[model samples]
Target: MEMIYLDNAATTPVLDEVVEAVADCLRNYFGNPSSLHRLGIRSEKLIKEAADSVGAVLHVDADEIIFTSGGTEANNMAILGTALARQRTGRHLITTAIEHPSVLRVFDHLKSQSFEVTYLPVDKSGLISPDRLEKEIRPDTTLVSIMHVNNEIGSIQPIEQLGRIIKSINPNTVFHVDAIQSFGKLGLYPKKWGIDLLSLSGHKIHAPKGIGALYVKKGVRLQPILFGGGQQRGYRSGTENIAGIAGLGAASKFIRRELETKSAYLYDLKNRLVAGLKDALPQAVINGSLESGAPHIVNIGFPGMKGEVLLHALEDEGVFVSTGSACSSRDRTVSHVLKAVGVDDRIAGGSIRVSTSYLTTMDEIDAFISILASVVSRVEKYSRR
Candidate 1:
């Protein structure tokens, strides 16, 4: 059987152009960006040009961008770096319960250090209300981190509204957005949105893994997390990954050029998959607010079946999808995101995430639905036995 890959939210296949760009950089530009020699200068120029491309796309200054290993590190640098640097201002922070582990874990670590953290709850639609946020703001709240789009359910948060509310209530509280899942797929203007910091991952947008960026609004003070040769404006100290950065730059350019076309295609694919699942399994329940989600992901739960069982059953049929976020999939635990949105444990336990990308096709979707229908039927039969 032909394999149908539907796990784009977890990670996407690297675009061929991106692969070639990375290979070209690895082959031709292997010099350290920090060295003063000719080779080093050549590498440094490439890094600067890459930064310029990324910055231009995001409408931020190139100097404000700091390259890291991926979204996890970028989030760590943003949350921890900002809190530590501005600790004198306050020791309190705020975030949502649905944020990725990167952001949530960093906050948990900070809580261990005596930083008060308030995890605001989301409504049934998986949205954090600005009104709820306003009620939670304290005098000591120094930073507020919220994700632009949820990784599992693809629910788009009211970021611009939240930003305005936070600024109005506590202008000193720096606003950070983890846009890893939304960056390339959505229209993001950090400055205009009042976002003080934004994190992005390359792999989510068809670039290679191990390369990501944290955009710090200029003049925002953040303590250096890594100590080294003062790279990334001394904020994230380390030699840059020239090849990965080159791939990221190329990927950014490609996405910028094709976003409108790619987005429409993804929207169609997602709608088709959701409609097919609902039609095939009328008992299937979608997990979040459909109207407010990104076009590429849909989370569905089937009653009386385990998510892991369905996951492997589909895999056995040559269909690929995910239970939820790839990072948290191993635990076999119910998704916190689902619980936050009021999904019962029974339904949440059976949830499967089917995500698509620009590269996904109609044939893949049809094949996936066919496999899924058979799998769900088999699971139901076994349960009845």
Candidate 2:
């Protein structure tokens, strides 16, 4: 059976161009960026070029970008680093109920350190109300962290609106957006959006898995969480991954050039899959809004069947989806996103997330939908037994 992978939200396959770029870097640019010698200068130049690629796409100053291992580190750097740096300003912070574990867990850690945290709840459609957020902001609020796109349900939050509200309420408050799942798929201007910091992962945009970046607005103060030789202008200290950085830069350029075309293509595929699943399983309830959610992702709950059962059944036919975020899939827990949007545990447990990539084809969608329909039917039969 031909495999149809529809879990791009978890991670995407590296493009051939990205692979070549990485190989070239590994083969030739092996010097540490921290050195002042010619080889080291070449590596540092490569890092600068990569930062330029990402910065150009985001319309920000290249110097403001800091390279890290991936989204988790970027997020940790933005959240923990900012809180620690600005804790003297205030110890109160705000975030949403549906952020990725990286952001949420960091907030949890902050709470232990005596930082007051307010987790704003989302509506049934997984949207945070700007008005509600305005009410939550306090005089002491120092940091506001929210995700641009939800990894689980693919819900697009009103990040710009939230940023405006947070900034208007407190100019000193640092606004951070976790754009791991949205950066390449959506056009984001951190400066224009009033975002003080934005996190991005290369793997989500078909780059190598180990590289990601954080956009720190010029003049924003962040204490370095990782102590080392003070690389990345003393923001993130480490020996840079030259190959991964090269791949990230190549991927950023590719995605920036292809974003509009790729997004429309994936949106069309998502619609076809959703329509087919509905036609085959009328009992299936989509977990989030069809019109407002990200075009590549659709979450559907087969009312009487467990999502895990349907997931493996589809995998048996070489069609892959997910119960939710791949990070939490193995935990066998109900999706917190669905629950935040008021989905019952039963339906949340039965929901599967089908996320397409720029590389997914219409034929793959058709085959996956056909297999999914069959799997849901069979699982429902077994549930009735």
Candidate 3:
């Protein structure tokens, strides 16, 4: 059977144009960017052009962006780098409880090192309160990291307001945002919003895997995470992934060209899926705020049914989906995100994440609704049996 893929929060299928761009680089731009010869210069120029494309989408200067292996590395570079560099200023760091493992794990490591961390809690809708943040921020807070969109529940944090609040309370406190899930889908202006660091993943935006970038606002100090030949101005030292960089730039350019319309297209598909699911399955419970959440993701729960069972049954029908963040899905432990949102064990066990992308179609949404309703009915009845 033909497949209907909906797990966009995990990753996206690379765009055709991006594939060609990467292939073109691999075929011709094989010189190391660090070499001083003409071949190296040509490779370096491609890297620069890619940075220019990504920078334009972010409203940042080309120099402010540094490429990384992927979002995980970018998050580490921003959180750990900023924390260690600014430790002299203050050792206090703050982040939300529902952040991705990349951010949370680094904080865990910090905790082991005796650095104080404050984990902000979210509401039932998986959103943090501005007043709560205003109260939690302190004069000694060195860095605050938050993700713009939750990969599982799709809740969008009020990043601009939060940034302003952090700066107002402590002008010197650095703000870092993990924009991995929101980069291509949402309109973001980090410079205007007072964000000191922002992370991006190419694979999430139809670019190749193993490539990402970090937006380091001018004058923010971060210690070097990777020690090497001092590429990327010593911030991240390594030879540039020339082909991956070219693919990333191509993806950014394509996404930015018609982002408004593309965003609308995603929202339209999301609304249909949500409305259709609710109409078909009243027992269905949505885990995130439908009105203000990210347009590309939704988490639906069916009481007494198992999320893994739902996942496998849907796969049997050639409709692909996931239970939660792919990074942590294999652990068999309960979802930390659902736990943070106060979900009961039964509902949380049955929740399945449904995420869309710019390339997702209306017909796919319609078909998923029909297939999902059928699967849920069978699964619940089988559980009763």
Candidate 4:
């Protein structure tokens, strides 16, 4: 049985080119980016070139991009750093209830410090109201953090509009976006979108894990999160992960060249799976707004089935998907995103998230859907017994 990997929202497999780039860096450019030797200069140059590659994708200045471990750290640095830097100016912040844990938990930590945080509720579509967000922003509101694409339900937030709302309401209030899931699959223009800080993860776009970046608009001051060797202009300190950075750069360039084509292909695959599932299981309910969701992700719920049972059943057929964000898959917590979008706890329990990548195939989608129908049938039979 050929394995069909559809849980891309959790993580994507690294591309062969990315793997070679990382290996090449590890073998040939194995110098510390902070060292003063000639090899170090080459490694440092590699870092700069990689930054430029990622920067081009965001349409931002290369100097504004700061490398970090991954999306979580990028989100942490943006939220915590901005709140700390602007605390004297304001102790109030705003975010959505459906943000990835990285952004939500950071706000929770700040709340413990007496910062007032207002969480915007999503409609059935898993989207925050711009008017509500604008009303939350005040002269003293320090920052607003939102994710571009939801990791669970695949809802695409109106990030550009929300960014405009935050800036228009209070120019001093910084806007941070966790674009980890949307970076390579969608168009992200920080400057045009009025985004002050945008977080990205390399692994989401076929680059290696353990490397990501934060785009801090020039003149936006954020307190340093890491203290070491005074690297990354004192924003994030530590010896740079040279190999990972090289892989990220390689992935960014490749994605940039293929983005338009890749996006169309993903949409084709997603639509095929959705259509197939509906035809096979008429009672299957999609969790998010089909009109506004990302092209690479889809969430479906079986009215009378448990998600885990269906998930494991699919696994037996060489197909893989997830119950929710891989970061919190095993927590046994109610799906916060589904709850926010008004999914009953029982139906939410039956929800599965199927995410695709550029490499996913139409044939794989068809096979998974056929396998899923069979699995659901067998599970239903056992349940009726």
Candidate 5:
């Protein structure tokens, strides 16, 4: 049987155009970008062009883009760099309960160094209220980091509204958004939304795995996370991954060109999947807000069976899914995102996330549902025995 891959929220397969771009860079642009020779100049120029292409997608200047080793590094650079730089001004930060480990772990690290962090609670739909954020901001609050879309549940956070609230309460406070999941899927107006720093991952959008970018508004101050020859305008250091950068640039252009039609297609697929699940297994409970969620992800739970058990069963049938964020899947713990949204232990433990990509087709989705219904029935039957 042909494999039906549905775990796109973890990572996407690199595109053919992106592969060609990377190969061209590796074959021809072998000189170090920092050298004074013609080959170095050519390499530097290629990187600059890539930056411009990626920046165009976000409506920001090329100077604002800092390439890093994917979303974890981007989020770390934004959180740690900003906190250390602004510590003299204030030592307080704000974030949500359901943030990815990259953002939450940074906060935990800062807390060890005497920073105060307020983790705002989410509603049953995995959403934070702007009013609650307004209440949390203090004159000493230095940063507020939030994700544009939840990686596990696909809940769309009110980023623009929260941005406005953060600025209104504390204009000096820096607002950092992790847009790794939403960058290519939805429209992002960082400037208009008052976002000071934004993080994105190339792998999430069919670019190479070891590359991503952080958008830093022109004057936002951030201390360096790495030190060496001052690459990325001294924000991130070390030699640039020329081939990965080229692939990232090509992928950004591709996604921008396809965003409109691709999003519509994924939305239709999601609706069909949700409806099919409800019709086939009425006992399954959806874990997040379906109406306001991202177009490609649907997280649901079968009350009595374990998600990992079902996931393996589906894999046996050549259907791939996930229990939660791929980064946390190895921990053997229930999803923190599900618990934050008030899913009880029983349901959260049994939840699985099925995420699609623009490349996914309707036939594959129908086949997945047909196979999933059978798997759930078998697992639940075994449990009752």
Candidate 6:
């Protein structure tokens, strides 16, 4: 049986076009971008062109994009760099309780160094209220970091509204957004959204792993986390991953060209999957605010079954899904995102996230639903025994 992959949120398969781009770069553009020779110039041109492509997709200047080793590094650089740079101005930061470990861990690290952090709570729908945020703003608050979309639950955050609130309260406070899950899936215009720093991952959108970009609005002040040759405008150092960067560019271009069509297709797929699951298992509950989420993901909870048992049983039947974000899968802890959204411990532990991509097919989704229904039925039966 062919395995049906429903874990696009963890990482997507590199598209054929992106793979070809990377392979071509590896074959022909191996020279160090820093060298002053013809080979180096060729490599440098490719890197710059890649940056330009990604920047064009987001409607930003190429100079504003700094390449990093995927979203984690970009998040670290954005939060840490901004916090450290603005330390003299203020030492207070604000973020949500449902942020990815990358952002949360960076704030944790800052807390260790004497910076004060306020982790704002989310509502039952996994949303942070702008009014609550307004209440949390302090004279000393220097930065507000939030994710554009919740990774596990697929709930869309009110980024533009939140940005306006933050700007109104503290114009000097940098507003950074982790758009790793939303960049390609949603319409993301950092300038229009009033975002000072934005983090995006290539791997999340069919680009090769190990390449991502951080969009630093032109006037934003950020301290360098890495030191070496003055690459990435001296913000991020070391030699650029020419091939991976090229692939990222290609991936961004692909998404720009197909975003609308793919988004609609994904919406249809999600609706079909959710409807099928609901019809087949009435006890199953769809979590999160469906109307306010990205159309490509569905988080569902089976009332009497462990999510891990269902996950492995589906895997055994050639269906692949996730209990939560791949980065936190090893911990076996209930999803922090679900808990933040007020899901009871019993239901939260039984929640599984099924995320789709533009490449996922309806047939595969149906197959997954068939297998999942059977798996949940078996688990429910076993529970009685």
Report the C-alpha lDDT of model 6 over 1-385, residue by residue, as the tens digit: 4789899999999999999999999999989999999999999999889989889878899999999999999999999999999999999999999999999989989999999999989888889888999999988898999999999898899898999899998899899999999888888888888899999999999998889999999989999999999887899999998899999999998998877556588889988887888788788887888888888778898765688888888888888889967779988888888889988878888888999998899998888877887888888888899
lDDT (tens digit, per residue) of candidate 3 on 1-385 = 3889999899899999999999999999999999999999999999999999999999899999999999999999999999899998888999999999999999999999989999999998999989988888888899999999998899999899998999999989999999999998899999888899999999999998999999999899999899999999999999999899999999999889858556688889988998898788888999878987999999998888899999999999999999977779998888999999998889998889999987778888888999999999998788888
TM-scores, one per candidate: 0.97, 0.98, 0.98, 0.98, 0.98, 0.98
Q: What is the C-alpha lDDT profile of model 1 across 1-385, one tens digit per residue?
A: 4788889899999999999989999999988988889999999988888888788778888887888999999999999999999999899999999999999989989999999999999988889888899998877888999999899998999888999999999888899999999888888888988999999999998999999999999889898788888887788888898999998998888888767456577778878887888888889998997888888889998876898899899888888889967779997777889989999888898899988887888988888887788889999999999
Estimate the overall C-alpha local distance difference test score of candidate 3: 0.92
How many pairs of residues collide in model 1?
Answer: 0
What lDDT does candidate 2 reach at residue 289?
85
Native-to-model Cα distance after best TM-score fit, residue 270 in candidate 4, in Å? 1.4
Tens digits of lDDT, candidate 4, 14-74:
9999999999999899888888999899999999999999999998888999999999999
Query: How many pairs of residues collide in model 3?
Result: 0
TM-score of 1: 0.97
Ranking by lDDT: 3, 5, 4, 6, 1, 2
lDDT of 4 at 183: 93
lDDT value, residue 153 of candidate 4: 89
Clashing residue pairs in all predictions, respectively, total 0, 0, 0, 0, 0, 0
- Give the CA lDDT, 0 to 100, for residue 130 in model 4: 89
Q: CA shift at 233, candidate 4, in angstroms?
A: 0.5
